[model samples]
Target chain A: MPQTIQQKFVHQVIGHSATNNRLASKNKIGSGSAPVNIALSKYWGKRDATLNLPTNGSLSISLPGLGTKTQIERLESQNQQTDLVSLNGQRLDQDNAFAKRVSQFLNYFRETPQTFFKVDTENSVPTAAGLASSASGYAALVLALNDLFAWNLDNKSLSLLARLGSGSASRSLFNGFALWHQGQQADGLDSYAEAIDTTWPEFCVGLLEIDVKQKPVSSTQGMQNTVETCALYQAWPQQANQDMQTILQAIKDHDFATLGKTAEHNALTMHATMIATWPPIVYWQPESVEAMHKIWRLREQGVAVYFTMDAGPNLKLLFLETEKPAILQAFKQIKILEPFKS
Target chain B: MPQTIQQKFVHQVIGHSATNNRLASKNKIGSGSAPVNIALSKYWGKRDATLNLPTNGSLSISLPGLGTKTQIERLESQNQQTDLVSLNGQRLDQDNAFAKRVSQFLNYFRETPQTFFKVDTENSVPTAAGLASSASGYAALVLALNDLFAWNLDNKSLSLLARLGSGSASRSLFNGFALWHQGQQADGLDSYAEAIDTTWPEFCVGLLEIDVKQKPVSSTQGMQNTVETCALYQAWPQQANQDMQTILQAIKDHDFATLGKTAEHNALTMHATMIATWPPIVYWQPESVEAMHKIWRLREQGVAVYFTMDAGPNLKLLFLETEKPAILQAFKQIKILEPFKS
Candidate 1:
């Protein structure tokens, strides 16, 4: 009997001893929680699509309060042929897109043909609104799985498993800053995120929600299109890698100006590559542009506020605690989160 | 006296014989008119700023009705020590920014230190509103200069002179389709635009005016900033050159699909480079983003409409006559013009 490529990769990360422990689990209920992360240096353009290996390294900051909570338990009856999944408080049908994806991920962990899991998940943030629920969701799920099997794998091992679910999920395993290393390998065993271990107590993130609806294009598909069709994208991986290093240095030095400027530039460059794509993926709506202009105006008026955008139209602002009053006055609806503070 | 680089280039284009004619002329009034041209493949970076040599070739379509009309004559008295410039019906002060730029350009053709010109220019389109009035203004001014001196120089020679004023002005020397060659010479003698000679009568341009006020940053400065600070801009010149050939081929083949797609992608890529620049150059307003979404929506509904943007917020839409009804229905304020038609 030969293990699948994914199984081989998983086994390599957790070792053959842990692989054996998976079959020893039966009906133990395990639960875990994780936080969403906003990328300061974005991850885009995968080197290996199947393995979700990024072409360049990325850096992020996690919001501790806004994230996902999940619980998992092995099904007791052999008659249950499929995994039962629920979101928030409602049970999701197996045919649901979310359930289907979760089931596919669970396939990597099934001990036997008759083994099934009942998975319950809840998101503190809006799902699929580019708050990166999948990052925290998959991270929490991997932790739950780790607890269920009693593998006692370290955070790095759990991050590797989380990355197999979503590329950004690797960064969500940590509470503060995390750096996802873009490993130079074919098998992608080295590609995982670890905590940066630096915390800026004054650092703040302001979420300006332009739209909560599902994005018109998924980041996965948008990145693929950009990598395939955007000629300007040829320079992105190099710039992104450089930005990652700059951001890491900024975090270590506690240089807010360098960090804010580099993060904003990195996000804009990522969006630029998407804009240069053939079908032209423009995530900016009228409100998005308006928010950008507002940010620019505030900057012109001597405010130190800067912003970074994801694959969706929402903007996540970066500013120190000193500018909180100005940012609050300017954006009345902004949801402010202090990442480093309790 | 040693000639300036500009004077030497001008002499090389018009010949030493025309250089003498420029000096011999005194009081003859010369008038010329030219249409503003919209670039299908944008000219963004410069290899030589002194000679206005571009980094890549470009393609454009001339708007026959929207342009500049200019009249020029040498000052008869030595008391008139400065070039007197005016726009529309108002006489501009010698210290005005527009007058200063024009006088600076006219210095290349000055017969002597005391030589001066009275220039009156009128633009049918909005000045500095991203309508490219500068392209047409420079082209008409060059033509008026040629007429004043009775140089009898061809359009190619005139285009060389106009390019010294503004890079896009080289294409404005011809109606219909034109291609500006990105010459590979130290002196920039080979960099001139010529008529493409293939016209699609059904080709239509719809102007979506987002703003008519003065642009915050000039295209000249914006191009320089992008070239200098944008890391992603390394791939731009090659993509722009390739797009030039593709657009030229599309014009010859009368393939509207290929032409529109390439032109829009080129424009977006150009903007992408600017966006990736440090201190990011964003030309889109809220209305501009709204218009872009509208254009994308129209395309999703099977309309063949596409748009191109310059360094300002306005959009120049491209579509065939068959889609005119659909475009008109979509954008009520849009002003449509046919390049090949009167």
Candidate 2:
């Protein structure tokens, strides 16, 4: 039988995080929010399956307006410790796939034996819509629970904990650009994401919703399969590793052209790995492809814009804020778009 | 003004062939045939646009029965020295795209400014239908003209000549598996295809024609665009060079699995390079993706089969002869398939 999460963590927790006064701890509710991360270098496969460590290093920008707000409330005493997860105000079944995965991560945070908490995760973006909703949700939940237990852990520890929930969540701990290194450590101690404080005032995100529903194959599963198979992916690691350097330098220099090109290519590289896998995973729709082509056409007409996609058909168009009007005009020329400012 | 091609290669032709009795080389028709080669590792971008040299190497197998049989008849008389080209019984205008390309190649074979020949090309493969008809058609036309004038050129010289007409046409000169090497020379003199003559009797080609229309972007234009852009392709040359060695060894070792995996992966890599281009050149249709998935699914069920694609949406599934029935049954399961045994 599995031990209670508090007992599991007592033995597993690393040094330096001292517990607060246990005697004074009482039932309380705490709310925290985290923004969705828009990956520039792209996080695809995992290196450590148990810890959810990434296979390739990545850099991401936080979308301040889009994310999840989760309220963690300590539940009343019950016969059995059971964590409840509610998404968009609908109570999900405990045995359902999403709830089970959430519980798996939550159980590791159980600080009190025979104690449970209710997590209400409300998303500013569509849930599981390839907008990194789970990354924000898990990051927010971890943040809220840290307050509930009075565990004032540093951002690194918080980021690591978020990774245990969703790999992309590691970057959500930071406010701006964050780099998640593909660490060499087997224990995942060195794998946490670090925030890059620099900001570009002109950087803007253009979200074009080709579809809002969840992808056919989730990013986690897709990455796992691509890593195991896909021969073209044999070069993806070295390729992306070099791209990271280029994109990082571009970002530091505020070179929008170089940054946009590198980011766009890196996303395609990730998608290529997915497409080269057995059965050839594809997330592109006719409308999505059309939108990308229109963007390219707009660039030909002198619009400074580029695009990146995760595991879904949605496109995240990155451009300078000054080009917003041109980008909007280009979008107007394209039909079937439901745009949200990323 | 662009100089006529005859002036370009006048000194390059070897002098071994004394024209067989100048009087006997009259208006009699001569025929030569060559098989269409199916690329396992695809050729996408061009390193030298002027010489038609590919940026990446590719491996291919021949479809012997599906090819072109052209009849070359020396013209009785002509004042300005013209090469009238006809395809599939249609007398194509000299200024038409295909005819112009053929004329450009035929001009290189002109022994004298006044020498002229009429070329009639017939193709077993579909014309401009992604069936590589131009490859076979050009190969046969070049072969027949070589016989007509008794040029007695070696296969390397013939392959180079064919490439001037169409890039992939260079491979069709071979009887079995052929590898096209993207040589390092700037002048493209060393860039030519070599025939790997080993025959795998068990090897079979399952052709599925998804569509026969002309590609949205011609192969030449697409390759030039990809080589100019697609940042992910920065590593493609090295990746493909390595794949070339592995695939060549697999062919020599008769390792079908290694050959299949490398070929399939290489095709995807080529497609990735295209997809990563500025506007993203995509060739896949819904049915084409469905066909690829069905092939992968068949493999999961223990059928030793793999697939490759060219610039168009058609699929060429490579499998052992022993698994033909199983492969056909799986194809039957795939809807919208117009199967042709190559």
* Predicted model with the maximum lDDT: 1
lDDT of each: 0.91, 0.74
Per-residue CA lDDT of candidate 1, range A1-342, in tens?
116777677778878788788877553898889999999999999999878899999999999799999999999897899999999989999899999999988877877756899999999996534597999999999999988988889988998889999999999999999999999999898899999988799999999888643247888999999999998889899999999999999999999999999999999999999999989999998888888888988999999999999998899999999999999999998989999896
Query: What lDDT score goes with residue B120 in model 2?
Result: 84
TM-score of 1: 0.98
Q: Per-residue alpha-carbon lDDT of model 2 for A168-245, expressed as tens digits?
A: 898898777888888887767677788887877778877777754223787788888988876566767876777788
Candidate 1: which stretches are off by over 4 Å? Answer: A127-129, A212-215, B127-129, B212-215
Error of 2 at B43 (Å): 4.0
Clashing pairs in 2: none
Lowest lDDT sum, 10 consecutive residues, model 2 chain A, at A333-342
